[model samples]
Target: MLPGPRRLKRPSDFGATVRRGSRAATPTVVVHVRRTIDQDPPDFTRVGFVVSKKVGNAVTRNRVKRRLRHFAGDLDAQFNTDVVVRALPAAALEPQRVRDDLEDAWARAFARAAAC
Candidate 1:
């Protein structure tokens, strides 16, 4: 589970990050990354996951979300950033692929941000 401070819980936070953040997509996931300047110490990045019904039924969606939370927890070392991860339907079908895609998409998201 992600620490409380590292989780993006508000709808406003999700909207703002997804709207303004740089985006990168892999076969199983899409990641939106935004650099933030508001947190007091900003030692850790905030993250949220979106696993819609399109991904699966309730059980599958929860499983995918749990996987994403685990992945996001591992990536929280990034400071002063907000990340939203959206799972593709393929994510429910390929658990291993989700991990690789999450890392790849995040790197690509930052690369895209840098290029902009």
Candidate 2:
């Protein structure tokens, strides 16, 4: 069979780097992050996405995943930490709405991480 897409092989490469090394959340999504303190100089970090069927049908789920991936890629430089974003059912409301919520969630997560 043919090989899968290159992007699928490197999931971690698509995530952002928040200021802190832990996870946080908001109303729209749940961020789960684990820092690698063991490594002398950490290697590439890892990230994953989790969206439930409640979000919508297969197509809708794929669309949401794509949006999250895009957002993660775009925000990679803004943060300096690893994150796994779990999309909430509310995220299926609208593209822009979901984006807005995700942004808000990220901000909250960053702030919480900073506090710790």
Candidate 3:
């Protein structure tokens, strides 16, 4: 699990990440990268998950959230950014694919964030 401070818990934070953040995506998942103004730890990067109802029922959505929360450890970036990983409907069929897609998404997200 992400440490409490490293998690993006509020709705507004998620909204900002999606709205103003740089984005990178595959067919299965999208990674949003937003620079944060919060004055907490400098290198800490916050993360949130958005597994919409289109992905599955509650049980399945929770499962995907858990999986995403686990693998997203590797996504600990050096900047003070808010990162959101949004799942697409096709992710219901395969969980491992999400990790792979997240890896690709993270690379693209960093590139895009740099440009921003």
Highest TM-score against the true fold, candidate: 3
**lDDT value, residue 54 of candidate 3:** 91
lDDT of 1: 0.86
Q: After superposition, how far is residue 14 of candidate 3 from its true place, in Å?
A: 0.7
Q: For model 1, how does the per-residue alpha-carbon lDDT over 1-116 read when each residue is reduced to its tens digit?
A: 79888888999989998999999999999999888867463677888989999998999999999999988777633446888999999999989889888999988897776666
Where does the lowest 10-residue lDDT sum fall in candidate 3?
35-44
Question: What is the TM-score of each predicted model, taking all chains together?
Answer: 0.89, 0.65, 0.91
Q: What are the Cα lDDT values of the candidates?
A: 0.86, 0.60, 0.86
Runs of candidate 3 with Cα error greater than 4 angstroms are 38-42
- Give the per-residue lDDT of model 2 (tens digit) for 1-116: 11122122344433433333456666567765544344462344345577889889999888888888777655432334456678877777756676666677666666766566
By lDDT, the candidates rank as: 1, 3, 2
In model 2, which regions exceed 4 Å deviation? Answer: 1-23, 40-45, 76-80
Model 1 misplaced stretches (Cα beyond 4 Å): 39-41, 76-78
Error of 2 at 63 (Å): 0.6
lDDT of 3 at 16: 90
